[model samples]
Target: MHTDLWNYALALYARPGVEAACLQLQEDGADVCLLLCASWLQARRARVSDERVCALLALAEPWRIEVVQPLRTLRQQWRMAAQGDAALALLREQLKGLELQAERTLLERLQACSQQWPAGSDETADDWLVRLAPDLCRDHGALDQLRAAASALQDAEDGD
Candidate 1:
């Protein structure tokens, strides 16, 4: 498995169906960054705990509220306008970049905070995914697809 959260995320997200699954999960109000982190932890075999979940949530919520959401909101709001106006489109593209950067920063923070967590626990990645997933998406199929994709990514790595 990849050692860094960002690369792991990029790899996992690049997998077939993973991006769509993440988009679906995002639509259901789950944090994609958190979901990616959960997948990373699961790949790493980190044991999930209430305290760890709480810690990750506490670290992520504010950043999402203060940074990521605003960029995302603005970019989404400009979707129509950006299509008609080249200037607006450029600005929207920049906003998209900013939103991506914000997400990247959040991933970095999550990785930094969770990197020290030791592995070798009985907790499966499903435990991490389920624990961190929003209640709204607890039973969603996209979450299952994400899990399956993660497993496939891990399996591919294991083969290598």
Candidate 2:
């Protein structure tokens, strides 16, 4: 499995609308990360799949293909064509873009979820979400909007 791609999807899982999409995809027996990676790979014109990635690399069946194959391909190509630094550099840039998008999406989701938290419960809402889905909140990073929501709730509680 491509660790980078997996991390990217894991980050995206914290996004708004992504959890629902991920749940639906999960229900359909698809790895959400793999799907996201596939989308990235498709955009990059990389002909790869989670299945092929697992088969070739002996990684988990539901691994992210986008991260692995392109890197692997780049490495192989670089080995064959030592002067192909440009191609490798391009692939790295694209991966960085994907990472940034994933991070932004995650922050958006966290903000949305925090906004939708029930009134009269600042820490409670965060706790509930953390309990319900730890992966989304596990050191995922500070969401300033969510923090504001929590702060507002705390103030309300103090006023009461």
Candidate 3:
């Protein structure tokens, strides 16, 4: 299975626009390690090889350690700094635009993935959306936008 999926990844990687999307996603901080692993899987087609996946996960260790973990720490710090509801409210408004930027980056990544992968039926790549849905919706109505985008894609595909 891993072998097949690796071939699929190669096919996907070779797809005309995929490399550009991949590069942009990397620039957007979409977890290069995970992207590499997914790319491997997409090329190979079969289930990803455990050994390869493990090695790649190990490589991503630093990203988790240096990037995401620190961000979590900072979020905690921000919460603590709020002092009270009014302060929290002020911080929330101040951070809204930054949050929107992050969401846009993520949604762009997801749309790129959908464009590369087949979106027919239940096989659409739902896992990515599942992981991000909560954070994208946490502070805004972006979930509705996401849902609408997804719905439009589904409808368009169904029409085809």
Per-candidate TM-scores read 0.96, 0.28, 0.30
Clashing pairs for model 1 are none
The TM-score, computed over Cα atoms with residue i paired to residue i, of candidate 2 is 0.28
lDDT for residue 108 in candidate 1, whole number 0-100 = 98
Candidate 2 residue 63 C-alpha distance from true site, Å: 8.8
Using lDDT as the measure, the top candidate is 1
lDDT of each: 0.93, 0.39, 0.42
What is the C-alpha local distance difference test score of candidate 1? 0.93
Model 2 regions lying over 4 Å from their true place = 1-3, 49-58, 62-160
Per-residue lDDT of model 3, residues 8-107, tens digit only: 3344445445556544544444453355344333322323334544554554455456654454455556775666678775765566545434433433
**TM-score of predicted structure 1:** 0.96
Better of 1 and 2 by lDDT: 1
Residue-level lDDT of model 1, residues 45-133, one tens digit each, is 99888999999999999999999998999999999989999999999999999999999999999999998999767756448899999
Instruction: Write the number of the candidate with greater TM-score, choosing between 2 and 3.
Output: 3
